[model samples]
Target: MIEVRDLTKRYGAERAVDRISFTVAPGEVLGFLGPNGAGKSTTMKVITGYLPPTEGTVLVDGLDVRRDALEIRRRIGYLPEHTPLYPDMPVSEYLAFVAAMRGIDASARASRTEAVVTRCGLADVLPKRIETLSKGYRQRVGLAQALIHDPEILVLDEPTTGLDPNQIVEIRELIRAIGREKTVILSTHILPEVQASCDRVLIIHRGRIVADGTPDDLQSRFSGLRRLSFGVRGPADRVAEVLSARTDLRIADVSDLDGETLFQLESDADTDARPLLFRLAVEEGWELTELHRDRANLEDVFRSLTSA
Candidate 1:
C-alpha cells in the first residue's frame, strides 16, 4: 500500500515532478508511463526515499517517507533504471551482500538469498560474476537483489530495458508473478509492457499526471472520437442519403469496391452509430456483410494525453 499526495520534486528552480497524487493498493501493479523528461523516475525516487519531495507527502503503509526514510526503504525493493550493482561480485555473493546490507539476520541470509535466486531465475548464473552475465541475467541479478530482503513493495524502473523479446517476456512474467503478493510500481515508456503486466496505468507529462486508469478504462475515457466501419450490398447513393440524414454521424469516407459499398463513419465523441446504421440498412433491404467499431488502444491514449 502506497499513497502520494500532491507530490512535487524540484532541482533548483526546475520542477521535475509537480503536484501529482495517487495511491497504489496492495497487490496492485501500477504502470508509471511518460515520455522522456516527464518526471516518472523523479516520482519513484521520492516514493522510495531515494529523493525527498519538494512539496506534499508520501506515505508507505501509513509511515511517512520523510520521517521514516529508513523504515520505508526497508519495506521497499527498488531497481532503478540504471541498476547499481557490483559487477565484480558473483551473483550469489552479490545477493548475499545485499541481504546483509538490508539487515537480514545472519541465520536468514542464506535461505533468503537462495529464495530470490530461484525466484528471479538466477540459479544457473549464481557462480558467475555479475559482469559476465548477459543483459537479461544482469537485470535478473538486479531484481534478485531487490527481492533478497522480501520487501512488501517493489519499485522497479525500466526493469526490462535492453533485453531481447524473449527476455522481456520473461521479465514481464516475473513482475506479474511478484505483483500477486506485493504492490509494484513499474516505471517504463513501453505501452505494451504496461498493457501486458500492469493492472492500472498512470501517464505523467511535464511533471503532471495526464491520465490514470486501467487499459480499457483509459481507452474509453480519452477515446473522444470513434470510428465505425462496415460493408453492405446496396445502392451507394441511397446508403449515403440515409446516413447523411443522421446529424450525429459524420460520414468520413464511402467507396464502392467489387460491387460492395464500404462506409467509414466518425463521431465527434463515442457514440453508438451501429444501431441507427443497422436499422437504416434493414429498412433499405441492404445485405450487411460486415460491421465493426474501432476503439483506441493504450498507445493511442498515451499519445493523445502526452502530445503537445
Candidate 2:
C-alpha cells in the first residue's frame, strides 16, 4: 500500500507537483495519467525519494519514504522512464551486479537472478551485451533489475513507452501477472493502458489531480451530457424545429451534410428519447438512417480536463 498527503514539490518559483493526496491499496493497479509537463514524473520521483518533496509526506506501507528511505527503497521497485544501463555489460552480468547491490546473498543470487530473467523474458539475451539488444529488450532488462530485488510495490514511469505494438501487449500482460500479488502504480500517456491494465485512474493536469476513479465511473459521471447522433432524409432546416417541438427531447444542434440532415440531440424525459424521435421522424415522413448514443470515454475526459 502507498499513501501520499499534501505532496508538494517546487523547483525555484514553479511548483512542479502541487499539493496532492491519494492512496493505493495492496493488489491495486492504479494508472497515473497526464499530458506533457503535467507533473506526473515529478510526483513519482517525490514518492520514490529520488527527489525530496518541498512540503508533504509519502508513506509506503506505513514507513515514511523520507525517514525510512533505505527500507522503503528495499520494499519498492522503481523503473524510471529513461532506464540507465551499462551498454557494455552482458544481461547476466548487469543483473548480477544489481542483485548484489540489492544485497542478495551469493547463495541465493543465482536462483533469484534466473527467476527474474525468466519472468521478464530475458532468457535469450542473457549472454548478449545490453548495447546489442533492441529497445524492447533493454526495457525488459530494466524491469528485470527492478524486480531482481523482489519488491512489493512497483512505481513504473512509462513502462511501455518505446515498445512496439506486440511488445506493448507483452509488457501489459506481464504487468497484469505481476499485479496479482503486488501493488502497481503505472504512469503513462497511453489511455488504453488504463482501460486494459488499471483498476483505477488518477488523472492529473496543471500540477493537480483533476480526476480519480475507475474507467466506468469517470465515463458515467461525464456521460450525463449525452448526444444522440442521427441522419434524416428530409429538409435539413426543418430538422431542428421538428425535434425541439417534442416536450421530452432537447435538440442540441442540427446540420445538413451532403443533403442529409444530422441531429445532435439530448433527452429530458424519464425514458430514452430514441423511440419518440423515430415516431416523430415517421410522422414527418423524414427518412431515418442512423441513431446512436454517444457516451463519454477516457479520451473525452482527458481532453476536457487538459484542454484550455
Candidate 3:
C-alpha cells in the first residue's frame, strides 16, 4: 500500500536517509531495523508526511505524499518515539480530543473513543490524567490516540520502548492483530520483536538499504556456513577419521564422554551432512544418539549486513 523510490533526507551536508527504495504491500507488516543514526526514524518520518524527502517520491496507495499530504495523513496513524500527548487530560478525554481532530463527528465521538479504549485496555485508567499513569499506560494512551482515527496504515517508531516484558508482548500481539487488516511499518531496536511481529524485515545502515526480505529469506541468503553437532557411540578418533573422508566438510571439534563421542562439523551453507553420517553409522555398526544443526538466525543476518 506504500512505495518509496530513491528517497533521501538531508540536514545540511549530512544525509540522514540516503537514496533508498522499497514497497509495502497491503496488509503486510514490515520491520524497519538499524543501528544508532541509521536513518530508520528519518525514513518513517518521510513516509508518514512528518518530514519531506530531499529527493525521490513516496506514494500512499498511489497518491504522491508531497502533493497529497493531507490525504495521506488521513490514511496513516503515527506513533512517534516521543509520543505527542497532553499530560493534564484524562485518558478518556484525551482519546475523544484526538478522535475529533481526526474529523470524527460529535455524534460518533463517544463510540469511537469507547472502541479505542477497549482495544487499548484503557478502561481502568479512563478517568486518570495521562501524567498520573505509568510509562506503560502512557504508551497505551499514545497508541489509543493513534488508533482513535482508525487509519488504514500504522507507522510506529519504537512502539515497545520503555515497556515491560509483559507490556512488550501485549503490544507485539496487538500489532500483529492490527496487521491482519491494515499495513504496518514498525521500527524498533529489539530484534526478537521484529521476528515475532513483522512478516518482512528491512535493515538500513549508514543511510542506505542494507538488507530486505522475509526473515527466513535473509537468514538463508546470509548464512555462509552450516554447523552440525553429532553424538555417536564409537571411538572418537575412528569417528573423526571416518567423517573426515568427505571433502565437503571438516570436523572442527571432537570429544569422548561416557562411551559416546561428540563431533562438531562445519561445512558450506548448502551442504547437509546428516544423511551421510546416518548412513555411515548404520554401515559401521555405530550407534548414533544425537544430531543437531546450528542455523543462522535474524541477529546473525543483521550483524553480517549492517555491522562494520
Candidate 4:
C-alpha cells in the first residue's frame, strides 16, 4: 500500500505537485489521469523515490520514501513515458542486464529474466535487437524490464500510447492480469483504458487531486446528462409531440436529416427511453432507422475536472 500526505514537489519557484493526499490499498489498480504538466508524473516520481518531495511525506508500506529511498525503489517497478532502452542490445541481454542491476543473484537472474519474458510475451523477440522491434514490442520489453525484479508495486506511464487497437487490448488484458496480485498505478491519457483495466480512478488538475472514484462512480456524477438520438421516417412534429408527452425524457433537439427526422432526447443515466420509443414507433407505424446512445464516460469526467 502507498500513502501520500500533503505531498508537494517544486521545480525552482514553480510547484509541480501541490498539497495532495491519497492512499492506495493493497491489490488496488489505480488509474492516474491528468493533462500536460498536471503533476501526475511528478507525483509518481516522488512516490518511486526518483524525486524528493519539497514538503510533506510519501510512505510505502510504512517506510518513508525520503528516508528509505533505496529500499522503496526495491519495492516499486517504474516504467517512465520514455523507456530507457539500449537500441543496440538484444532483448534477452537487456532483460538479463536489468535483472542483475536490480540485485538478482547470478543464480536467479536467468530465471527472473525468463519469468518476465514469459509474462510480457517476449518469446519471439528475445533474440532481436531493441531497435529492430516495433513500438508495441519495445513497450513489452520495457514492461518486462520493470517486472524483472518482481516488485510489489508497478508504476506505468503511458503504457499503451502508440499501440494499435489490438495491441492495446492485449496490453490492457495483460495489465489486468498483473493487477490481480500486484498494486498498479497506471498513468495515461487513455480514459477507456482506465475504464477497462483500473479498479479505481484518480484525477489530478493544476497540481491537486480533483476526482477519485470508480469509473461508474465518476460517471454517476454526470447522470441525467446522457443523450439518446433516433432517426425515424415519420413527421417530426408528431414524433416530438409524442416523445415530449413522456416526462422521463426531455426533447433536446429535433432536426431534419437525410430522408428522415432526427430526434435527440436527454434522459437520466439510469433511464432507458429506447424501449418506449421502439414501442411508440411500432404503434405509430413509424419506420426507425438509427438508434444511438451517448452517455457520460470517464473522458467526460476528466474533461469536466481538468479543463481550465
Residues forming the 10-long window of minimal summed lDDT in candidate 2:
266-275
Cα-lDDT of candidate 3? 0.87
Stretches of candidate 2 exceeding 4 Å from the true structure? 225-296
Write one digit per residue (lDDT tens) for candidate 3, span 131-187: 999878888888888888788899999999888998888888888888898899999
Q: What is the number of residue pairs that collide in model 3?
A: 0
Q: In TM-score terms, which candidate is top? A: 4
RMSD for each of the candidates: 4.6, 4.7, 4.0, 3.1
Cα lDDT tens digits, model 2, 147-236, are: 988988898999999889998898999999998888999999998898989999999997899999998788766545445787898877
Cα TM-score per model:
0.81, 0.80, 0.82, 0.87
Model 1 segments more than 4 A misplaced: 225-296
Give residue 305's error in model 4 in angstroms. 1.5
How does candidate 4 fare on TM-score?
0.87
Output the TM-score of candidate 1. Answer: 0.81
